[model samples]
Target: MDLEKPQADRQRDPEVREPEGCLVVAIRLPVRIIALVVVLPVRMLWDALVVVGRIVRDTVLRPFGRALAWLGKALFVWPLVALWRWVLVPVGRALGWLVKWLVVVPAVWLYRHVLTPAGHATAWVARGIRAALTWIYERLLTPVGHGFRWLTRYLVVVPVVWVYRWVLAPAGRAVAWTVYWTGRVLFVLPVLAVWRWILVPTGRVLAVVGREVWTALGHAWRVTGHLSLAVGRFLGTLFRWVFVEPVRWVYRTVLTPVGHAVRDAVLRPVTEAGRAVGRATRRALTSVRESVRQARYDVRRMLFGEPRERVAMARREPAGGETRTLEKRVRREVSPPTRG
Candidate 1:
């Protein structure tokens, strides 16, 4: 099948066919004859009228239009543009500069020269007043305050402290020492004597009794401990022989064999079956997962209509030769022409 022919046939719709070549020529020749024979003079007359209208428009009306345009520009547009550029802009700039010099410069000068110096003078005057206050305090008030303090200390505080240290303290110490010694002699000495005579003897007897009782208790405790130990050992041995050994023997001889039998008959097979089922389930699930993954890849491939792997493979191929050719072309295009 011819591909271009089929495409051309599709482009030409069946409802609208082109006329034959001879039929087109026949139709066009008559139209041309009629136009030449009947319409030629009228067309010539229309052309003449158009030429006259164009000549009049170019010579007279166009000049008048040009004059009107020039007058409008001179009267309205030029004046406005010139006023804004030359008068308004320059006047605004000049006013800004004048204000800077007249108002700002003088204000800055007054602040720097007059106000600043006045502030400094005022500060100096305040410092002088403070110094005067300090001098008065040091010369007059400080001396008077020191004298009053010295008089108060010597007259009132010093005598009070001295009396407390020497006269009152010694008197109080003597009284306390006298009372303490008197009480010790009157009460404490007799109490000490009574305790030495009565309580010392009773305590010595109690000490001897406690020592004897403690020794006897220690001997009895040792005998009881040995007897208890022997009895406990005998009871433990009897219990082991009577109960524990028999139970151990039963477990070793009977229960162990039964457990082995049950394991071999039931548990092992069940365990193996469960493991086989689990392995089969895992394999089935893995196959299902792989199928799902392949299906998803196929769906994506169908929807997007291109394989990314092929594009990536194409990109990975080296393009060194193409790059060199492109570079040579670019150099030929960009470099300046050499002298012949």
Candidate 2:
């Protein structure tokens, strides 16, 4: 019984003691209703603007942009490309050749023939000077540098180490300890207390409020979307019934039969007559063409003597000579016998 009482009290404490939950519930319904009312018209307007923008882009802006791009390419881009390819490319190639001959070749020759020997001579002198300096440093300056290092270690480094280890280190440690306590008491503890005790609770309350507001907005947006869908469907149905059905009925009932009648009665006879006239006109044109061709040929024959017929050269007599007819007689010839 005692455990059950504790569990009941725990559940009731969450509901009764936390006024935030009750306040959120009290405000949620009205906030969402107001949000939906405000958001619906804005959402519809946004959708309408989006649709209009798409239509304008497709119909006006896209074609105008394409035409502008084409014009730019035609007027500027193609001419520049042609100039680069045909005129400027050849000129550049010629200039490159001239530079190679006049400047680059001479420079390379000067570097290889003149500068290389001069550099070698300079390098030899530099090496001689460097050898002398190296000798002086190794023989004379090395001992002097070591002597200075020894004096500095005893007079300066040793004293500094002794002072740091004996005097300054202890004093620095005392000062650091004092500073740590003072900062902790004056600044760190108070800031930490404020952060943990005051700011954390305030931030938690504000966070709860913000979360509730955001959730209400989301709910309202979803509800507005559903309402908008329902309204759009109703309007579409109304438009279909009021406008589309009557137009479809009139087309099917009245216009279709009337069109068919007009086609059969009036259109067919006129089409056949036109076709007959066309054929007759074509025949007359053909006769007139033949007459014109004949007249042209006669004029050509009168202007220039009749065209010479092409005669064929043959190796033997005509083929008709081989075929004998009753009107023609065959001839026979004798030849001498060959000597042995």
Candidate 3:
């Protein structure tokens, strides 16, 4: 019953085999033969080379690289680190301390003890001198200046004021009146008459003429705009009918059908033929390359003799208990959250 169950399963399997017909066998036999005769040996050699490379890397190259890295660090990095840590750092700190003591400390002391006190003393002296000058100006010079100003006002300013008030003022008024009447008769009246009569009427006439000219210019500009718009519309309509419509009709009605015919008849067949030739050329090239490789292999075999066959490495995938199947999806579903 167990055996029958397996047979039933095999019968139900989609991958169960069918016997090949002669044409299929004919085609497949050459490919399988080529795979076994050519590809199998090459695949085995490649696997062997991969294993040998891994072995060499693990046994020799990796350790050698690590050693080289360590040697490089010891030669280049460690020396620089030692120089910076032991020599350069100590020297730099010493130089910094020496500069602080020799230059910075002395400068600070000079500014604080000597320069600061000297500046304060000079400021005090300036303040004293300023106070003394202020006292002299207020007590002695101010009263003397006031008395002098009083004497000058009575002696010089009082007489000058009297002369201007009593004598000079009336004479100046009389002279000003005479000058005013003389200028009024000589220059001002005629100028005023000319401005009121001549300039006003002439300006009014020019203003009226300018207003009419501006109105005419505006009307002419509007008429010109309308005519330009009408001519542009006519020319656009003419161009569409004469050039654009015919060209559009030719492109859509004539060129479209011709293009379709050329593509269907000439271009398509030419492209298909080119693809077929390319496929054939690739197949021929593959056959030639295989033949050349086989010939070279045969020459090497004749020269060096046959090497011992290597055992294939074991696969890591499960072969027991139907661990995985092609029909099953690999994705897993996550659990939902608990209410707590």
- lDDT per residue (tens digit) for residues 153-216 in model 3: 9999999999999999999999999999999999999999999999998887666556445544
What TM-score number comes out for model 2?
0.65
Across 1-340, the per-residue lDDT of candidate 1 in tens digits comes to 1111255675776754443355443444444444344444454455557768999999999999999999999999999999999999999999999999999999999999999999999999999999999999999999999999999999999999999999999999999999999999999999999899999988876665564455444444444445555655787799999999999999999999999999999999999999999999999999999999999999998999767564444564447675446777798899999999
What lDDT would each prediction earn against the true structure? 0.78, 0.85, 0.79
Minimal lDDT window, size 10, model 3: 326-335
Q: What is the lDDT ranking, best to worst?
A: 2, 3, 1
Error of 1 at 201 (Å): 4.3
Kindly report which residue stretches of model 2 are placed more than 4 angstroms away from their true locations once superposed.
Answer: 1-34, 244-340
Better of 1 and 2 by TM-score: 2
**Pairs with steric clashes in candidate 3:** none
lDDT of 3 at 307: 83
Give the C-alpha lDDT of model 1.
0.78
Clashes, model 1: 0
Instruction: Identify the leading candidate in terms of TM-score.
Output: 2
lDDT of 2 at 231: 78
lDDT of 2 at 304: 98
